[model samples]
Target: MPTFNQAYWEERYKNDQAQWDTGTVTPPIKEYIDQLSDKTKRILVPGAGNGHEFEYLVTQDFKNAVMLDIAKEPLANVAKRLPELDAARLIHADFFEHNATYDLIIEQTFFCALSPELRDAYMTKAHSLLAPGGKIAGLLFDFPLTEQGPPFGGSREEYIALFGNLFKITMLHRAYNSIKPRAERELFFIFEKK
Candidate 1:
């Protein structure tokens, strides 16, 4: 099994092997952000590599938002682009160990990048980090669970099974607005804490 540790991810960035990074916020997430009426919601984009979505939130005036990542390189990259951003908003911490509450957690490439073994843990941590009735919204990779990945794939059944207990599945369907490369493979979902 690939060791999905901090060092492992740090090296992926150093080696420029982070192909999952689209270098900009993708359409599905942008649409989700566009629909959000509450600008002051405390939002988190954990494992937010390069943090383009976080950057987008900043541009849209989402002041109460933060992006956390285990790798400093990506966070540093985000900082370079948004130089005026508050330094504290770019958090360098492990997601599971990080302490805070948020009204919304944006999921993009983050979940698939985690080891399959950590799926349940990710779900539990997300539940804990959210405020009451808080939401976790974004895309999840929709494919067969296979060994060949840091970009591990999972089926719809798997997601329903894993998140069902702690979250109310408000939306869990294949994304209609994915970019060319991601079009049939991403599920845009919104899960509200139970």
Candidate 2:
């Protein structure tokens, strides 16, 4: 198992080992964003490597969007790509230690990239970061949990068990519009903070 710390991710970006980057906003997430009527909602995209979703959010006029990552490289890439984005919103910080609250947090590859031991911590942190009635939404890789990953795999049952206590599982189902490579392997979810 890898340490999966900031240095590990920084090295991955420096070496161009970010195989998880899709170079475009994911369809399921894009559709979800499209349905959102509040363009002013405070949004956070943690572990936002390359920030394609952040780009989409900005393009859609979500001015309060914040993009965070433990590694500086990806944030720098996003800054370069979207030069108009406010530099302050491109936060380079450890997600676990991040303290601000948000109305919505967009999850992409962030959850799977953490060590499985941090799953509970991730949920707790996410819960803490959301205001009451706020939501944490986006895709979760739906596969069996195993020891072989930075891109760790997990199942729907595990997710419900893991997050159900602190959040209302508003939507947790197989995503019908995932990018082809992720096809049937993802679940689009909306977990409202309880």
Taken over the whole model, the C-alpha lDDT of each candidate is: 0.95, 0.95
TM-score of each: 0.98, 0.98
Give one digit per residue, the lDDT tens place, for model 1 in 1-194. Answer: 86888899899999999999898999999999999989999999999998989999999999999999999999999999999999999999999999999999999989998888899999999999999999999999998888889789997889999999999999999999999999999999999999
Candidate 2 global CA lDDT score: 0.95
Q: Which ten residues in a row are the worst by lDDT in model 1?
A: 1-10
- Candidate 2: minimum summed lDDT over ten consecutive residues — where? 142-151
Please, what are the lDDT tens digits per residue for candidate 2 over residues 9-96? 9999999999989999999999999999999899999999999999999999998999999999999999999887789999999999
TM-score of 1: 0.98
